[model samples]
Target chain A: MIRIKVRPFFQLKEILKEKELTIELTPDSTVLDAIEELTKRLSPSFKDAVIDKNSGKVRSYYRVLLGGRDLHQLDDLNTKLCDGDIISFFPPVAGGNRAT
Target chain B: MSGWAGRILLVDLSSGKIEVEVLSPDLKLKYLGGRGINSRLLYEGIKAGIDPLGPENLLIFGTGPLSGTLAPASRFTVTAKSPLTGILGDANCGGGFSAELKWAGYDHIVFKGAASKPVYLWIFDDQVEIRDASHLWGKTVPETEIMLKQELGDSEIQFAAIGPAGENQVGLACIIGSNYRGAARTGMGAVMGAKKLKAIAVRGTKGVKVEKPKEFFLLIEELCEKIRNSPIYPRLSVYGTPGLTTLLNERGYCSVRNLQQSGGFEEIDKIDHEALMPFFVKSKSCVGCIIHCGHFFEIKEGPYAGEKGGGIEFGAIGPFGTHCGISYAPAIFKMANLCNQYGVDVLGFSTILGFAMEWYQRGIITLDDLDGIPLEWGNYEAAIKIFYKMVKREGFGGLLGEGAVRAAAKIGRGAENYITHSKGLEWGHADIRAFKGYALNQATATRGADHLRGIPGGELLGIPPEEAQKKFGTAEAALPTSYNKARMVLHYQNLCTLADALEICKFNTEIIGQGIGIEEMGRLLETATGVAMSKETLLEVAERIYNVERAFLVREGIRRKDDAVMGKQGQEAVASGPFKGERLDPDKFNQMLDEYYQLRGWDKKTGIPTRKTLEELGLNDIAAELDNL
Candidate 1:
């Protein structure tokens, strides 16, 4: 099994009741597999927050990044997860002066 | 024609004269008012080589055509020659001021020449008066507003005022209005000070009349419904911009300790959205904005307990909380209030103060320079003291009041190495090394190092690369790498320009993933003015306005060379945290810049739009003027 750090930020932290989490994933597991496993462990609200009900799409405000790159940028759900990988879940961000 | 008030109020302060001119309908169709019209007016009014604070400089406030209507967060623009960058300067602020100005039966207000004595402009519908403001000159923004309201005896009147920061001609001074809202950048307030003007107050009973009131109301209802149902509405109404705090740190994109490190603030937990939750009392919004992103906070417990204010957004918090190495959320909130009251741009204020603190830590500056103040990190006391001094332009604060660039030069003690600015304007928020597009965005930005003008937030916000590619026609945009990401910047820049021209808040529209887009803009225009505007035409107008702004800067000698960061942003790698070794790639930046220039139909070497490109955009006159340059 490969271990990944699953960190939830902003409002997600309030929902998770934890700032960071250690998720155990089977080898060769894709990001989709990791997400499903991670969400299954959380409350239903957290699960709903990760994925939209009507569209079955990940909500735009919830960002899942592997290492520093968003998982969606790299092979999407098909992207392979590696040991010691950090997957972060970020909430909606809008800034007047912030560049990101 | 229907959306416009069809009048421009001209106040010649030097002559104590007020005249009203008809706004040409053709000009309205082409420019669409707000920043677009303001830039056109500034370009026509001001000549190069004149002092930005001289009597020759023209200060203008242009409201969008849809400003007084039932449009979400419709705002106005303040345009002037910048005392900060000494170039084309404009800033936008939200609240009822723009709509009130619009209801006064004018699309724009132009202030010409310097007043011989302190004065304030008061407008009651079509009637204008230049009243003596000697009694109000040195008051804080809050004080001025209270005094003006009491004098006028009308609490309903909206106002824009400058405080001691502007009175002292601080280069980073901002014009405060709508109580905590401000045209807060590039020292627009200093221009008002230079003109010996103190404030502008207006009260109007006239209503905004559109070409098709029924159709406009239909469009407005539909938009309000869409905004209410949007996925982001709940999060915005709840967390506001504080939502971005932990998210930026999680991505290792947060600027910490003057960007010496990327993320990993020691007290990150103390200032996250959750920490600020206890202080959040209620939701607030501007004019017609339904998102209610503004949160009214009351600090119930802490050193700042009982302190209350509004408009505590990313601009204030990013620099106040993250960059300054401070995590006492209340202090951050309190400091932001002080900035609002003092009439200074929070981003610039916090940055310069942070710069001094970092310099003190690095031994570049010492206790002697700061009059025995330790200047320690996270020391909210010193930061507060400095902010007070900055507004009053006293001693050490006076030296730093000219902004980071001039201050660095004046210090001459290797302090320049610590300062981060482009064209004298301090870079706001992000550590450019961590974000891929920041270097190019900073360099090419007209007002200098501004991120809001063009943002690729969709890439960072988890929009899948394939999805973004399908929408924006760019694969590299979803990633911050220099591989053809310039197109993404251009795309957002154009859309944001559309937002500014239309006076829609970017928070409810573009930056928060999606709300108002080109289609919505076109529909709004058509419904309000009975004009058939396709998405393509709207985008063309946006592009035209952007180029006109660029041309304005070009006239003042801004070229490819001026479009650059201080080099430290790209040259020095991040010292610690998740992005320990990240730095901007020079080669990739140049390649992407070449692509951007080519895409813009600009001369690659000079970065100026070609004559043919100008003519194609229906700007032959601008082309002729640039030819003379």
Candidate 2:
């Protein structure tokens, strides 16, 4: 089993600061699997932030990061997770005069 | 003025005389309109080393060839001897003001001497009048705009007016336009105040004549289509430039607390584009622009709820939000409104305030200096109160009103060390460690740390991520590593200069399309003026114009050493996020500068244009002058 740490950003942080769960996953489990497992443990409001109820899918513009690199650069939702990896989920949000 | 208005309108407020005279075509082509034109004209007209606040300094408004035409984002240029930079000063603003001036059939408006009494310039087509403006002089920008519109009985008439800051001739005063847009940097409003011109009310119904209308229209449509489809369009259209905040914070480029830190704010969620969108009531567009990037926000909840204003632009958001450690959007919105109403540059004001906060924390400044108001980071109420004091020029705020650079100089303990700035102007939000190319761009920018001068196309140009990483090593290198920046900055500067000359918006070129490159711009120029020109030939003109401006700066004693970055940029590492512990590599930066100077035919060591280089660019006269110097 692999242990993964996940941090929520933007709106996701507002919703799920609690639960703050460290989940044990299968060694080759993808980010999608981890997100699904976390949602099952979350309150209804927290679940609503990550997934669209009507589409039953992660909302477009929802950013998922694996080891600080965006998941879109990885295997989208299918990239396999590793032990002690940090994943972050952020909503579609941007501010600042300068782009990071 | 061969391809221009063929005349300059000179208004002597002291004598109330309006004189019209032809501006030589040689001068027009040499300067290439907008700030360049204004610089040359003012350099010739104003005596050297005159006080910036004195009536002897001339304040000129200039428009470019593309301004009144169907070309995009054609706006106006405000030029004066700067109270901020103490050198050649020019700030370009977007709105309909420049186009209106063009429609009034003038290429430029030059204000000379000082009015014996408060007055405003009212230009309706060919009719010009200097009317009593005593009642309007103290009004806010919005109040001035509304009152002028009501008085003129023309809802579409555009006005560029100063608020109390300008009336008081505050060193950082900006000339506000369209209620929110401004010629905001270099204290041009103080120049306006010195000239005793409260506002300029302009309306022109005369349509701009294009030499080849059909071709111009087709080209404009094609360009607009390209911009509309570009990936940048969606972000700019939806959230304006503020959309970059998340990207910057995530990448660790955000300048937090006056360049001391970087990272995404815990409260960043509250200030992102998505969060701010619900407050956006409507959109505003510049002259002949389809892409309305101007955001008008209505505050729904907060101490300043129900307050309406335009802009909370990227610069305002940084100093008012992340830099000061306040992430509340409504508070930023209120701060923006206050700056607008008071006629101050929001970026300049907020940066100075942020510096003060840092100083207070370090014990360089006490609460006594702040008039008993605690100078804490994220103190929004204190920030708001200070804006009023700055406008009124009261208490310690009077000293702070002089802006960060001068204020630091006056308080000379360790306060100067905390003031992070380059060339007297405060740094914009782009932290150089994360974006080295922008560092170079800001370092060399004519207006001192202006981002628009050269946008570092490698980062902005949309390369595939893997390829970009390999080519640039990091996002920071993307700008400096690109071989095209020498040509890119030169090209964009020319296009932007032309935009200012034509009095159009830069967004028309920058945001609406794949940008009007030298070739396209040459075509547009030819089509508009019936002056046949090749891309290479037009580029030569651009080069000549650039050299002339360089000569002016050189005459003002600006050198390679003056272009160095300030604060802990070279010494300190970015403290957080992806680029933590990384600072700009000096050797790489020097190499880039060497390459840039070599490309411009400048002396590599001094960064001055070589006589050979100047002569090659058709600046023989300027070269001769430099030799004399």
Candidate 3:
């Protein structure tokens, strides 16, 4: 079993309401797998907001984070999950000016 | 200038004569307005092969058809042959000035010859006057803005003026507006100085008219809604551009320590957008914009406590923070404030200073050159001190005032090796290794190394895989892939040039993403200008405008090799972070460039638009003119 922790930022938190969520998933579960499980448990409106019903795919700009890094840089939707891995769902939001 | 005041005002300071002439209809139709119109006029009016900084050079301020209208972010463009790049240069500025210029009923103002003394232009609707500006000449940007507002007795009137640095004609000096916003690249302010023009003050309540008001309003409302709901809107609204620190750090695109390495700032947390928001007092808008990305800040409980300044964007933050190795938030804010007050481009200032620090470290520049001030990385106080001296053009700062390219050339002993720049302009915050498309775009941008020239929209938007694959012929092609990025860049360049000519902000196009294409843009233009247009026609006009500007560059002696990025720098891998060991492949870049030029109907070998291509684009006159050159 793997424990996936989710967090959100800016307006994404407003949509999520809850600061954090923890769910059990099968070992080696991908981000897409966890999102599917989470959406099934969520309200219809929340599910609609998270995934496009027409295509049954995650929102194009919706960001899925594995730990602190963006999943887009990793294996994307197929990125494997591990035990006690922290995940974050960031809706498409622009970044402010800051020095790297 | 019809919908305009029907005249281009030319002020010759050396001759002390102000001449106004009506703009030809063909010029207006072909060039449209803003930077495009300005470049066309400059090419036609100015003698070819003239020195950019001499009395022969002309400095122009152009307002587009959408400026002073209900269009969002309809700003002004400052255009000239740059003393810095020795090529075509244009910089856009957002504030109230451009709108005011339109209200005063002139599409563009052209200044020719040089003045024996400093002078400022005052325009009140139909009335125009040039007054001696000996008193206003030496003032800093903030002080000058305040004094001009007070002298004019109307806070509502807009003013674009230069500071002491501009008066000195420093190559990187920028013409600042309302103390913060500025037309801040390619040394446009120096051109203003060469003309001996101190400032331009405008006031007029005469509003602009749209061909179809109802349709224009409806379209504007829909565009506004789209912009508001965009995923990118919140970040821009909350943090301006300072929010990119984390992303740039993670992606290894941040140009740290003059591109010596990428990523890892010790005080990154302190300078991030979230940390700075608590100091934000209000949000400000440009012209008719509702987005109001400009933030006003008031610092509390720090060394620089009680300091009130406008929000610093990504370009300012990155150079001040990563390039200078200064990580503390307060220090960065202070440095930004100093640059703002002095009326210099922050990116130019910081990049030049970064080179000086590197040179000093390499024993190329000594303590004697720095006037006993130890040039060290992360030394915030020292950095601020240098900024003060540079603005004043005093001591060691005098040499530094010439900008990185000139300063490096003067300081021999491999000093140029440390200067990371393209066409005399330093690269902004977005490092090229992580985003090669931007790198190539910067190299060939009409303005030197400008990111706004070709904004990477699709990559930033995270386009859907199937749609991306269909459009690009491969999914990877849409995802910042080096393959075929040049074609994508050319598309963006045309789109952006069209946007600039229309005087709309890049944010409008980017936020709308794939939802709004050239078709939507054509509809907006038709409704605004009362002229029928199709997407293809508008794009053709954009292509023609681009070719005309390129022809001007070619006449100015710009070659195909000039478009290529500097060696080693272009191929060097990012040293650290998420994209460590990533470098742009030269072969792929060249291949992409070849395809891009071929698509544009340009000569594959020289990268110049062929005579046939120019004739097809309805630029037969330009083609003939290029032949003579």
Candidate 4:
């Protein structure tokens, strides 16, 4: 099994109640697999925060980046993960607040 | 005419004259209102080679048709030739002041010439007066507003005031309105100080008339609902813009220690958005806004105990906290409060502070230069002291008050190589090296290195590939590192122009990945103003406004060379973090510029609008003038 470091930021950090954590996954696991692992270990609200309850798909505004590269640029959620990869979950940074 | 207040108040301070001019319906149709009309007026009123801080410059305050209505986040724009950048300068502002100004039965207030003595304008529903403000001089923004309200005997009066920084005519001085809102870029307040204008107190009970009130109300409700339902709403409503701090740091996009190292702040957790949550008093909002993404906070138990303020956003924390190497949240909050009270632009002030720290580090400046203050990184005390000196124009701070680009020039020790600026204006908090779209946007924005003008917010927000393809014509447009973002930038620029013209917040638009798009805005405009504006026609008008601002820049002799992100900030690769070793590619940047200019229908070589392009936009007069140039 490969181990990936999963970190939460912004509201996700508050929801997860943890700054950073390590999740164990299979060698051929994709980001979706890692996310599933997170849902199993983390709180149910954490799953709700990242995925839409209605669609069961990751929220559009929620960003899961691998080593600073956006999932959209890589492979959406299907990109395979490697051992010791750093995965970070970021809450939406745009769309709300007045532009400063 | 239905949506417009139909009057423009012109104040000639030199003669103590206030004249009312009927706003032409054609002008309103072409430029809409707010920044769009303000830029057009500035372009026509101010001639070339005039001192920006002299009596010759025009200071305009403008609100749009939707302002003061139930529209979400209606704002205003203050426009003047920048004393800092010496080009087209305007800053969009939020708060209740714009709504108040609109409700005062005037869409625009244009200040001309200069007053021989200190004065402030009082507009109480058409009873306009220029009163002596000698007593109010040298006061902070909060003090001015409080004194004005007491003097007027009306606590409901909304005010826009400048503090000691503007009184001293500091290059980066800003105008503070409605308690904490700022018209904070490009030294508009310096122009106000030169005019000897202290404050503008407005109180209005007049109502704005809409062409189809029912349809407008329905449309606004729909838009508000969309904003409330956006997935980002819950987080933003709580954390506000400070939420971007940790995200930016994680992406290696945050500027740390004057950008010496990207994402290099080891104490990121100590000062991220969550760090500020414990001080949060409640959520605040602008007039009629639904999202309410403003955090009102108080440092109850810290070094900054009893310090309370609002409107502290990424601009404050990024500059003072990360860029200056200070991890203390209370100190950053105090700095933000100080900037608000002193009428200083936090981005500009902190950028110069970081530059000074870097200079001190490299031995370019000495203790004597800093007047014995230890100019070291993370020294909030020294930063505060230097800030006061800059506002007061005392000692070395006086030299730095000339702004980063000009100060570096005066220093003359290859100091210019350390700071980052475009067209003499300093950049915002975001490090543009990692994001190609933002880099290009900063290079091409008319008002110098401004992210609000056009920074591809969809890409930053991580919109889906299919959605990005549908909107920007390619999935690559959604990727931050993609060079094929010319179309995306152009699209956002037009949208931003439209949002400014409509006087609605861009947060409620597609630029921020939700809320209304051009189609809905066009419908709202048509419904509110009885104007027949389809999306296509509205976009043409947006293009027209952008071209007018561009023509103004072109008239001022700004070409492709002037529109650049100069210095090591743009050239050197990021020193640390997830996106390490990333620097802006000059060739890719130039290619994007070529594509952008072609898309804008301008000369790619000189970056000037062609006579044909100008004429086609119904700007034949400007076209004729450019022909002479």
**Model 3 residue B301 CA deviation in Å:** 2.7
Which tens-of-lDDT digit does each residue in B384-499 have in candidate 3? Answer: 77877887778778778787778878888987777666667766345676566676777777666777787666654345656656755655645554455666677788888877
Which DockQ value does candidate 2 get?
0.09
Report the lDDT tens digits of candidate 4 across residue range B1-629: 57788899999999999999999988899999999999999999989879998898999999998888888646899999999999999988888998888788999999999999999999998899999999999999988998999999999998888999998999999999884889999998899999999999999888788999999899888888888888667666767778777777777777788787777479988888767888878777789788777787889886789999988888888888888898899998898899899998888898888888888999888999899999899999898889889999998887888899988888878888778888888873567787888888888888998888987887676677777799889888877878888988899899999999888887778887768789988878878888878888998999999999999999999998876788766768877876678788888888988999999999988988998889889999899888898
Candidate 1 lDDT, B192-276, residue by residue in tens? 9999999999987787888888888888888877776665666666777776776677666777888777776768788877777
Give all TM-scores, in the order shown. 0.95, 0.86, 0.91, 0.96
Model 2 ranges with Cα > 4 A deviation: A1-100, B1-4, B460-462, B465-504, B510-515
Best by DockQ: 4
TM-score of chain A of 4: 0.77
Compared with the true structure, all predictions reach lDDT values of 0.80, 0.72, 0.74, 0.85
lDDT of 2 by residue, B57-145 (tens): 88998887777787774677888878888777788888788778878888889998899788999999889999999989788888888
Candidate with top lDDT is 4
Predicted complexes: DockQ each:
0.28, 0.09, 0.24, 0.38
Tens-digit lDDT track of model 2 for A1-100: 9999877654466666642458889889988788778777765355566656786555544546565455544565678988987777666543322211
Q: Whose TM-score is greatest here?
A: 4
Which candidate, 2 or 4, has the higher DockQ?
4
- DockQ of candidate 1 is 0.28
For candidate 3, the TM-score of chain A alone versus the native chain A is 0.70
Q: For candidate 4, give the lDDT of residue B293.
A: 73
Q: What value does DockQ give for candidate 4?
A: 0.38
